[model samples]
Target: MPASTPRPVGASGPELHDHLTCVAAPATWLSPPDGRLAGGPGGLYVADRRVLSRLVVTLDGAEPEPRDAETLGADRVRFTAARGALAVERVRTVRHDGGTERITMRNDGDGIATVTFEVTAAADLAQISDVKAGDPPPPETPLRDGAVLTGPDGYEVRLEGRTEAALVLAPGDRFTTTLTVRAAPPPVPGFRPAPPDGPPPWARTPLTVRSADPRLDALVAQGVADLGALLLADEGDLYCAAGSPWYLTLFGRDALWAARLALPLGHEPAAGTLRTLARHQGTGHDPVTEEEPGKIPHELRPAYAPGRLPPVYYGSVDATALFVVTLAEAWHWGMPAEEVEALLPAAERALAWLGTFEEFVSYRGSAERLPNQGWKDSSDGIQHLDGTCATPPIALSEVQAYAYQAAMLGADLLEAYGRDGDRHRSWARGLAARFRARFWLEEGYPAIALDGTGAPVDGLASNAGHLLGTGLLDRDEEARVARRLGELNSGWGLRTLTAEAAGYDPLSYHRGSVWPHDTAIAMLGLSRTGHREQAAELARGLIAVAPAFGHRLPELFGGQARRDGAAPVPYPPACRPQAWSAAVSPALVTVLFGLHRDATTGQVSATPLPGFGPMTVTGVRAGGRTLTFTTEDGAPASD
Candidate 1:
């Protein structure tokens, strides 16, 4: 077996773990773990541009030796370091338009200390895509006036404080100064941040969890905080930006899944995400950007490099279907009828897009587009049992499931709202039948996908787990899938691919890593299909590993099995505050309780799983009111 290595999405992007990230939507700051913005993707970025590339501090020309660092919140971090007899503390805070750092130096030695405190800063004005591709432009000297740095194209960074202060401190005395770095960049056309005065979209109706396991509580709290930090506003509505550092932008599939998983929190985020995506829904055929009428975009970037993706790319085959699914799910979670009706046209359009696909929904690759269009969309994401990459015109198994659910849900929404839905229901039936006949393998489990020639790719993968709750499979079929999923478990969580498969690299992006969102999705499906034992087992795995990663799950991790004494290995390039990954925390609460809301009645229900002990969840929103659920020793939950 090859040793696990970090593979960046870009051809030569730097790994992510080397730096600590602080984010406030459009503005993000990445620096060394010690909070110094040295080189290599460490900078203060605003709207997809690296406005400040380097910021380092020194005392008497000697840098402090970093002693400890702590993340206080998604947008704040604190670092402690020492040089000689002087102890240094730096508190960094990130905001949407700028950032701030408060530095304090204290003399611990008996004698007084005198030192020259110098701050060095520079800006590269480089595109984030170029930075991710490991081709950042050389730093440009910014015209300095006092503590501020000004660059070309309306780029300005104000470092407000004494930059070169001579400090004389007596024993036990402290010297403190605050450096506020504010940026003013040329406005990119499409992106915006939520109003600073308003609370985060998720915080409007908060969901709190308490369980017998402290780890579960900690995971939920941390995950919710991370999700709050990733929220971005588009056309006055809020949606979760995909993740920190690299992906602090709108991603259609990622945002949709995050909102859907977090439905337990409230209907606000779902409503916001649906409206935002609908506002950008595809309107014409354009091969360059892959835009087709009614197609939901793959990603929304302020700008992209030449020969790369366009600003509003519509290459995703699943986001369109997911849009309908999320809207319907949100409606079930007590979204107001007026709100649902307002978006009905967009949902209808998305359903029409689904109808354009023949037989089963599938995607064909292009030179300028992604080869695979599903969530596991890496170049080599889809492969055969023999490790050969699946060719395009590929029909992924999970995508078919998403399409089926979307069709059925769209039909339900249409009929409820007095619109004709016969065609949608008919379409869903045909899709389910085709999927059953063509996508299943002789080995008792569904294949990962069907290739260009309509042959089953025959890779035992986590994709099949998605089928369990989608209603495309029968009860027995769902049971078989739930059983097969157990084979993919790495003790910590479900692996993307089974270990017996040929291309099962534990650290590969989508080949064998454990994605928290993926595992949580499987857990939800298992619980829905009456496979409570399997769901509980996977839930326990996630809770057990939460403490190791500080109760904040990353985008993905090594799929290595958990050992009695060893912790789960980190996938170095994984995004820590990824939206979908963070949403897994709320998804866990939903799965453990087998929670659901009835669309017509506006009633919420729960069937808590056994062996989870006592658990209580408060502020769960349904029918426009807050409800609290408590279950003791696996008993039935009451609201």
Candidate 2:
């Protein structure tokens, strides 16, 4: 095996570990005899800290241990141990694979054993791996609840040239393969190596972004810069990572979504995400292309043989049109009209996809799914309690609006560029008209329709969040929408759903947590439509309370109702410094500052707030050129 491919592409190889290796035992727990690592639905785990680094193995008569460990794509675990003159390195790679691990020996040394690995899964995962001893690794063990069926072929090495047969395991505990095994007779030094360096955790709270907290600021800046470096760019545009451990690469929707603000902060690398996502724009509805003639791609990568997720995933109902959405927003921030013009076909095709998505994505039962395509796209994401989700023939509610808004904008861009102006405007007008007629609910307001089936997946879900931000809802409707949101937007911020709704749960990830970024979008939407009081109320409340959190707003927090002493509950497992988490704050600034740039003529406007005085944002670029803005100290009449 090639030495490069031996260890996994992004694995902790023979070196000082990066961010993924190190683990912190609570300062309270004295180091146990051996750290325990197990594999389960949660993913890979570690037992001992810095216990094992490189596990080398050699047959009794073999020369030296093979330095290369074969690559196992999915989940796996390993332990390092030595028996007699021979050394054993055990590993378990599970498929939806599961199990427990056990090791015993009779040989020259007496010491400890260690293991390392992580579990990767889409969602409903449950598996564990640990050390054990028996004829078989014990299937009935609670540790074996998710044990693998028919594990890998077992290998047995006599302990005292003793013991029975070797047990089989998955990357499952597939229990951690013991690192070093010891027999009674005598003692040789057992493997006691350092752990790999893992990604550092956020500074002990009080994380700040300004120089006043210089030490912590440098740390935060590095975190910010690393996230920036992680951007996988194509051509000139960039895509953001929501891909996670596996696909943490670029994603079309991720790019455009994050790009909405990337450029504003002088994030130049994001330019690559912009250009790349646009280049793969759809041109026709070949199931393979998911490409509807001109829709921008949802994913971009090389080596995607014909029909693979590498180059495309039509599963997303909004990426393409949003590609145009980002294009327009980019121009608004000073990228060139020519650049916008360049993506014209992509924009037009994206507009075309508005109808196509309804046609193909109707979960009515069309195609299986594509990864990283939708918000709920973990493997079991499509389905509810039932096995199968509505299906591609199904049209989700928010997607409908995303399509409408993205299409309408694409058309507006077309008209602005003087390219098929009449046709584009007509399409834009038609979509607006259609959206009002079809999506608006008579009783439940906009019935949060799951699709054309007239199914109401109704809730005051944050799903309706984009509605306000996009300017898709007009003044009259915006008022109604704002009024409706009051119930969901408690003092803290907008809840994912109203507490009264069935889908609502203060702790539910999608059901009702208060996502700061999501709340910010809703706030911007309210502010956009001149709902100043409502927007300001939200911003002030959120900003005022957020600093209690050390000024770095986390991705989200529990949306539970507030009493006096309750500290906002941080979303349990949210990633800090997430691409959008950082970006949203700036958008909040823009909303608060009332900053708007007209890409067409390159005019910058700043309407300061009552207490807020002159604000200057230098190196501000729009239409592909940089410009500066200075406001007089005096507040404008409105401000």
Most accurate candidate by lDDT: 1
lDDT of 2 at 345: 69
Task: Please give each candidate's TM-score.
Answer: 0.95, 0.60
How many steric overlaps are in each model, in order? 0, 79
Per-residue CA lDDT of model 1 for 601-636, tens digit only, reads: 778889898898899998787767788899996888
Q: Show model 1 residue runs off by greater than 4 Å.
A: 1-12, 140-150, 190-197, 304-307, 364-367
Q: Which candidate has the highest TM-score of all? A: 1
Which portions of model 2 show Cα errors greater than 4 Å? 1-230, 243-247, 266-270, 283-292, 299-312, 355-392, 450-452, 469-471, 541-554, 611-619, 623-639
Score residue 612 of candidate 1 by CA lDDT. Answer: 83
lDDT of 2: 0.45
User: Cα deviation in Å at residue 230, candidate 1?
Assistant: 0.4
